[model samples]
Target chain A: MDKTVNQKAWFLVLPVFLVVAFSAVLPLMTVVNYSMQDTFGNNQFFWNGVGWFKELLDPSTDLGGRFLASLGRNLFFSLVILAIEVPLGIVVALSMPRQGWTVAACLVILALPLLIPWNVVGTIWQIFGRPDIGLLGYVLNHIGIDYNYVSNEIDAWVTVIVMDVWHWTSLVALLCYAGLKSIPEAYYQAAQIDGASRWAVFKAIQLPKMNRVLLIAVLLRFMDSFMIYTEPFVVTGGGPGNSTTFVSIELVKIALGQFDLGKAAALSLVYNLIILIVCWIFYTVMTNASAERKPQEGAA
Target chain B: MARIDLVDLAHSYGGNDAPQDSFALKPVTMTWRQGGAYALLGPSGCGKTTLLNVISGIITPSRGKILFDGEDITPLSTQKRNIAQVFQFPVIYDTMTVGQNLAFPLKNRGVPKAEIDKRVAEIGRLLDLEPYLNRKATRLTADAKQKISLGRGLVRSDVAAVLFDEPLTVIDPELKWQLRSKLKALHRELDLTMIYVTHDQTEALTFADTVVVMHDGRVVQSGTPAELFDKPAHTFVGYFIGSPGMNIIPAEVRGREAKVGDHVIALNRSYDKLPDGAKIEIGVRPEFVEVVAPAPGLLSAKIERVDDLGRIRFARARLGDAKLAARAPAGFTSPDGTAGLKFDPSHVHVYADSLLVEGAA
Candidate 1:
């Protein structure tokens, strides 16, 4: 084999670099710039030099308290979403019809919520949770249960969680379904021949085969649920005394509603850093666990 | 551990009302004796896998019963029948260690811990898997994984029969022979009935004591390797079992003579009552016919080329517009175009409509 160093190959990467610089890097640099400066009226700016970061982290000031509370709410919501959706999604995927026209029908129905625009989903849920006009709220109230998302904090939280589950559990179910479908028929036959019970087969074959896809599902649900905004915003408006306010909603309120550019920029940067760190930890832990028993060349 | 019998077994995936030609497996009635090693050899889609699956109780035949040592097991589930099967590709639980994968079947059966450990150790030692006993099964190469699949099948001592469906297909070419011989040795030590299904003749001939050749959803022949070479029961068996397959040329027969296009040949015995208007043909292997100098009282053929295959040489010749192969002796020179061909009378067999014809003395 000939060993040659080709420097011209670097030219081929120029287009992607230019695209990323224009779309992602340049805007991110602007955010970074704003996070370190305090803006005055008429577009005048003064350097703050990490003062906003210190304030956001203090937890005693108003900006720090809001950031910490919203971050806590975001983490709790993500944990609850994972706990309910992952198992429910796997059960739905398992119970789905394996063959026939019913499979197509079920897939189409499962894909319905994912295709709707996010704001539209929020609007639909907002109207659907109104006790005066919506069926769900009207039925719950008529059945002797007090249910109103607009004026009650607990109800607002419940409405947001249930709405999120209804909207996104399908994604997890579809990913697990794809994982299940890729298993060959021979595995099932071999299991039957080995006298393995249904539960045994599930444990030994189906679950192991689904590990990679389940990791993807968990990461996606975690990140998406962490940064959720539109649906809860439309339904509760971070409302009933800020009970359902997640980190994205708080960031929007700080940056747009009060025009606190420096604080909002600092909060957004921290939020991005948290997500990146969490995802990295997730990927590293999972890959290391899967690779613990390393493969080597065989004697034969 | 038990003899298996297929009584009037037949299956048509299309349905019972489907025509005979549509049957995936035609009615097959054969007895596989206890502790006998058998190979089901055929080309792709010849129903070899279907037959093996039927015997293993994976597929319920549309008609007929499967018997295990005189007990009817036709309606039994694969687990209840106590059969084991290894598939073409390895099927191992990725999360389990090598030892755990081998012990899974026993554990599922609720075997005692002491017994499970004993059987797992026995199988591990047999397959040389003891070194990697604690490693995850998924971390091994494909051949090692296949060995794990085989180990799982062999771990259970009371299985009726162990069925292999081309288990060597995923193995490397060099490792195939080693694994194949290992399986043969296991059969010897265990004295268990094993049915190996493969499309490769080499694998079949080297592994089994008796090879059952199938064609077009029917078992064409069942015999030892020597028997299959000396006498093929059907034209397909003749054409399918050899490197350069048997030469089957059309001929006319009467009394003790067989007539090619222009040359008359003598038969060892009289095949006078060959089927009426049936297609008569002569079948002989390349090893039986010798290429010689053109001489009197011998059939003359045009020798096109001679192929030296390390151990033996074969001559491809044209006999009156029909192609045939004959052995070329060492230092045998080809004269301009024609050569004398001498066929051993006892080695030649007559066939009627692709089926062998038994001649009277």
Candidate 2:
């Protein structure tokens, strides 16, 4: 058999490369350029030579302080979101209707929040948590609890977290539901024959079967919550006094609000790198752990 | 171990108002003796699995009572019934080691740790799974995982019965024989009432002492291997149990005689007073019918083809408009594509409406 040395295959890949360069590489290059340079008004630019990166890293500097605070806030928010969503998602998935028309109905309801645009979700929650007008706000206020998001830091954080949870927990639930559905009916029958209790079935069968999807859910939820901006931005506007401000919101504030292009570009690069590193770690650790049980998890 | 009795047991997935044909399992009354290895033999959709599930209490019958050693267990849940069922597909806790998978049932039932360990070890050795006991079950091949599933079922010593639902479907062809023999040995060592459900005739025949043949949601015959081969109670069983099956042809019957078209064949015993307007058919296995030179007073047939199966040979021949297979003697040849069929009268059976008719001696 003669092996054909084909250079024509490279031409087929050309279109994809051009599309990626236009859609992603070009914009990222611009950010990289801006990160290394300072920009003056009148569309003028000059080399800054890592000055913005230095300022961004130093906690004593204004840019660095804001960046660290928001990074900590983002990490904390992601942790809390994951802690609440994964278990809650599994529980919700377990309770989902196994069959009939009701299954479609329940799936639709679970998917409703995920289908909404992020900005729309933010806007909805912003109005919904208002002290005077919104249903949730009005009800909470009528119950005699002191709850005002605008004036109180904890209230603002709570509202933003709840809003994010309400917006994204469906994503986790839907993923887990798909995982649970992939399990064959025979597993349940076997579990019953084994004299397994509800919890034992979950621990032994359901949870193990859901392993791959839960890893996916955790990674997706972690990355998404870490980069969350629109909902919190609309609901709290980074107040009560920056308490609800996350990394993405702070980056937007620097670039658009303050016109600190150098600082913002540097922050953007760092933020992207952080998400990348965390996701890489997650993928590596998870794939390695599941590799011992490779063939079964593919059913997911 | 316990004897299981299905007293008028029936099931229909479509509810009570559904028509008779819609019943997944037609009304069945049977008793399975304790410690007997039984095989529920049938093709797919023949209600073998449904019957097995009913026995295991995984499915509750729509009507009638199930008895475990004379105690009604019709309404009992599978977990409470103390019945172990291995499914068609191997179901193992993927995260657990093979030993842990075996121990899961005992652990779930709050068995003492020492007892669980001893049983797990015993089952491991029985299935030759000792080396793989500490290995994750998910890493094993389909055959080994099936062993783990079987081990889990056998781990519980107090279970009344063990039901296997086509458990070898995923096993490799070469390994099937080994696993099957292992299961037979386990049944003997454990002495549990084991009911194996399989669509494969070879698997069913080799695995069970008594094979229960089912067809179209009914138990056609439940008898020993020899009985099933020699006297299948239904035409379906006769056709289903053997390779190339029994040759059945429409015939006109009278006392001590049956006619295939104008060709008369002698019956050892008289099948007189057969039901009126019933479909009368004569069934005889190829092993019982001999293909020979065309002769007088014998059914004449045109030899269509010869199938030499190494050990035995069968001649496919046409009698009038119906085709039949009959045993061809060693070094046999038909010079003019014509042959005569000689049936062993005692081995021949008469069927009416697909059910076998017992002839009067």
Candidate 3:
């Protein structure tokens, strides 16, 4: 048997390649150029020969040490957000009604928070967590607890985490609800015939079936939490010390706050590399886990 | 094995209604014997599925008593009813192996591991799925997945009944015949009370020993296939069960005969009382209608169209304002112009106000 191959299909993708090269590749090349060179004012540049990268790798320097610390903090925050949000979102989704006008009402309400601007979300939470006047901080302080997000690093971290949950938990819930709704009613009927308890039904049927969507939710939450900046920066401003200074905040302070352009460029490159590596690990683990299972056709 | 009895069952989606919007399924009383294969045959939106859901306890009836082996189970949950149902589409878990999918219910019930394995093997063998046991269920073809669904239902022997809700609708035409026969064989082997629901007459007639014909939220007729074919108690039953359906031509009842247009056909049986001004209809199956040359016969017809279905020939002819279908053998020939149609008096049925008149031929 002979096979026919089409080579002209590459023409259709040429425009997309050009667009990506102009938008993404060009800017990335500029960043790489800046990272490798030391610049004084008036555009005079000299090759630093990996000098900034070396210093950033050394733990004694402020840049290297602070970068490592913030990286650890970002990882911790992403893990905590995933741990709390995924299951809570699933629970909320499962409790939603299957049909009716109430389902539409619930969906609209859940989507409202996601539609708000990210910067506005940061500002709103900033005022909402104030110790003296804010509703949450006032209640906690009234109950004989000291809650000051500005001065305390732990409080800042907690406030940022809570704000994240409030802002992004609805996304996970909506995805889960869509997954649950896509499930055929026959599964429920089969479960009932099997005399499965509510928990058993959820474990065997609901959870396993929502695996694909749950992977999506986890990856989205992980990436978003890792790149988190607006809300935490607005609330903490990198904190009273180095405690709540995540990678993004530290990168911003180096690049713009201190105007150390060459080092900032090197730090930004390292930051991007970290995110890329972590995201690649997450994608690899998830895909490997999925591939280990039997290859079921038509799952998508 | 247990008999299921539905007493005074009625279901309404909302509260008490007006005359037109009262109930989806009117109050019904029926009993299904153990080890019997039954079918609920009806058109779309005829409430056959609603009645089946009520029996399965998926939907609680507004007013009814459901008895399984003399035990009240009306208020019981579906899980408590112990009834297995195969739905319109295949619903097997995509992530599990064929063996694991079949073994799920048994595992949920905490059956011994060995017993569960044995039962899964048995069901897999019955379904011709033994070779694919290790394969994920969703990887199989549509028909194969449906067989897995069927096997999942048939895996458990302790269930009270197995219900099929148009389970073969998604199956290919050639596979439907094979699966239907397999189900019949399974019913005979297991002696489980199986209730199959479908709007297809061929499936109902071939699979069920007792076919329950439903129309407009009511059970029009419930009897053996032969009984339903030979003697349909209602006009709807006569119209629904046969291929080409039954020819229901409006007629007027005179002493011992029915008048169709200007021709009067003699009846073989007598009715005690034919109600005054009651609209009557004469029903005759296509098989019983004989076509002959236009002679001085009981009725005259013009041959309109002839349909040859390989083995049988169907001649649709016009008799005055009414059209009648006549079935003949494959080699039977008829002229295209005018043809005379005659009906055997004994095969004719007289219906008044949709109900079959007693002792009417």
Candidate 4:
């Protein structure tokens, strides 16, 4: 039996395609237009022909130097976020209660930080880290440590990292919790019967089970942290010597503040390409590890 | 191998709040002779798995002790008990090769590497898993995975006994038969005491030397297959053991005679306790109840249906509102409307309140 070639079915898909093209493709083409040419004023453009892209690549120019530094900071922030969150999430997920009303309570509490809007989280932390009235800063200062998140560069970076960790560790924990839940009781029972220790069981059963979800968590955390703008902008306003000004902040500054649309558009493409490449690497490594975990079939 | 003794063991899922009737396993005492093959045959929720779990030390019995060769092992854990169990579903480490899965139990015990390899190879070959030793356990068919599960159990040298909790339930029928035979062969060769739990009667009867039939959390009877077939200790056994269970007809007992509806049937043994309040019945297997021609026999029955089952034929009839099934040889003749169904004197079993009367056949 052969399925009829339903060419008419594409008509149903055409609406979605048209909507995506109008919403995403049109704006992206405008960005591409801005990136390729120099816009001197409103409604007037000069065909620069990759001139802006060339200027954006050179570190000597103001826009290019800011873009490279911000890109480096974005990559570093993403790495730091992942490093703190993944293991911390797994540990938290492991310690979480598996059953009863406590599970609901824990899940709700774990999700509370995630539910608070991003800028709101930044605002909350901003007030919470103030030296005069906030608990953290006041306690740290009284404890004989010079702690001020506003003016201190290291302190500001610590505050951002801590805020990011508090905000997103729940996502990783939730994902890992789901992964841990999917493993059957039989596997644990079998491991127990085989006299496997707790660590052995985690290594053989829990770790392998968590691989796929950890991949998703890593990719999501990386992408979200790389393109982060709202939270840091609300908290520190990209101050303390331009330390926390990531790629998104730099792009916003060039595009909206200085109105350098061409440079910002090119930087946005570079930033998008970086994320795409890194995410592809993450996905490839994770999937390859999973595929490798599957022991080979016999020749017969 | 060690002899397993369950001493006055009982289990209830609920704690102090457990109702009296909620006992999953009613207090029972039994012993399994070392190196003997035994089958715990029962229906679902009959406490067979509970009993197996208790013996495996997975569950501590609410009361009583489990003794292995006269040593109380009830307080020990599963690993301390050193027993192997195959569950209903196959369990193999999906990440490991077949060889690794087989050798896992041994490796966990800190067995010498050379010994582990030898044992793994031997068990793998016996289960016909040698060719797929390097293959991943996850890639195999269900039967092959089940073979790996069984191999895991066999890999351990210090196992007290191997317990199977309906281990073949997941296997295809054809592979079930094959695995059953392989298990039987292993039992014979290794001289290991094995207790198999299953609801299938044929598997129980064929695999076990002694079959302990359980019902409602209590052991109804434990006997050889032949004894269970010939003289079921309880009416439950009589009804549960046979292919088409036993026929139980209400009867009134007096001296050496019994009254079945409107007819008087002679009993081989006299019953003194023939009170009107007591429930009395005659239990007979279809194989034992001989069908005779026409009417004017001891008890006349109206033939409802006759099923020719290749080698054996069953004549189902109604006699005074009591349904009777009698098995006969193939090509047995049946009358048009009515026929005489008589219980063989030696095969007739009398029961009082569902309990078999001793020496009353």
Model 2 per-residue lDDT tens digits across residues A190-297: 999999999999999899889889999999999888988888888889998889899999999999998878889999999999989998999998978777566754
User: Better model by TM-score, 1 or 4?
Assistant: 1
Each prediction's whole-model lDDT (CA) = 0.91, 0.90, 0.85, 0.86
Task: Count clashes in each candidate, considering only residues at least 3 apart in sequence or on different chains.
Answer: 0, 0, 1, 0
- Output the number of the lDDT-best candidate: 1
DockQ of each: 0.52, 0.61, 0.48, 0.41
Residue-level lDDT of model 2, residues B183-284, one tens digit each, is 888888888889999999999989999999998899889999999999989989998989889999999999999998888899998998899999999999
In model 1, pairs of residues that clash are none
* lDDT score at residue B194, model 4, on the 0-100 scale: 93
User: Where is model 2 more than 4 Å wrong at Cα?
Assistant: A1-22, A295-300
Top DockQ: which candidate number? 2
How well is each residue in B1-361 modelled by candidate 1, as lDDT tens digits? 8999899999989877899999999999999989989999999999999998888778888899999999999999888887889999889888899999999999999999999999999999999999999987877888899889989989998887889999999788999989999999989998999999999999999999999999989999999999998999999999899978999989998988889877888889899798898999999998999999999989999998999998999999998778999999999988597899998998889999999999999
10 residues in a row with least lDDT, candidate 1 chain A = A291-300
lDDT of 3 at A249: 92
**Candidate order by decreasing lDDT:** 1, 2, 4, 3
* Candidate 3 clash pair list: B348-B361
Candidate 4 lDDT, A1-300, residue by residue in tens: 999998999999999999999999999999888888767668677787887777778889887788888888888998999999999999999999999999999999999999999889988988888889988888899898998877898998899999999999999999999999998776787777788888878887898789889999998998999889888998888878898898898889888988877877888888888888988899799878766655422310
Q: How well does candidate 1 score on lDDT at residue A152? A: 90
- Recovered share of real interface contacts in candidate 1: 0.67
Ranking by DockQ: 2, 1, 3, 4
Clash number for model 3? 1
